[model samples]
Target: TQLLEQSPQFLSIQEGENLTVYCNSSSVFSSLQWYRQEPGEGPVLLVTVVTGGEVKKLKRLTFQFGDARKDSSLHITAAQPGDTGLYLCAWEGYNKLIFGAGTRLAVHP
Candidate 1:
């Protein structure tokens, strides 16, 4: 089982800017997932990357898994204020999910 660690515990940016966040682990994972959470709400799954070197795009957001399956990244283009929230990365481990320390993003309009 891998222990995930996310970078840039907090970020504040202006609208229309771009940013990237990362999640890394020493152990390999079968899959990795990204999620977004708003205050007072449960996290909402964004994307899941399974195969190594795979990339997935959702509107202005992009997700990628490292070739070794030990790291992942999330990129946002032209970020909007609505994008403000907590971003999390999780991987399946021992029949449960091991989540990284989340990144809190605040996009100012």
Candidate 2:
């Protein structure tokens, strides 16, 4: 089984503060994906970095994959209350997907 380690299992920040979440693994995957899940809703795919050292931006959020392809990070330029949610990092495993325990983020005004 692939094991992914996520940092800062819980995060609380004020609006407009910049924050980052990280995921690391000893195994390498073809791609690294980031998702955000809210109460009662399924996780939504925010972005995927397919190549090593790749970076993708979604509005104020930036996603980056490590050069070695075994880690990834999500950075928010300015956290917002709307951004409060469970952030998860995932990788393909067989025909399914394996996700980290996830980082619970709460951005308050």
- Give each model a TM-score: 0.96, 0.96
Task: Give the runs in model 2 whose Cα sits over 4 Å from its true position.
Answer: none
Separate clash counts for every candidate: 0, 0
- Write model 2 residue lDDT over 24-108, tens digit each, in one string: 9998878988999997899999988899999999999999999999999999988989999999999976888889999999999
Clashing pairs in 1: none
Instruction: List model 1 lDDT by residue over 7-105, tens digit each.
Output: 889999999999999999998888999999999999999999999999999999999999999999999999999999999999876888778989999
**Candidate 2 TM-score, true structure as reference:** 0.96
TM-score of model 1 relative to the true fold?
A: 0.96
Off by over 4 Å in 1: none
How much is 30 displaced in model 1, in angstroms? 0.8
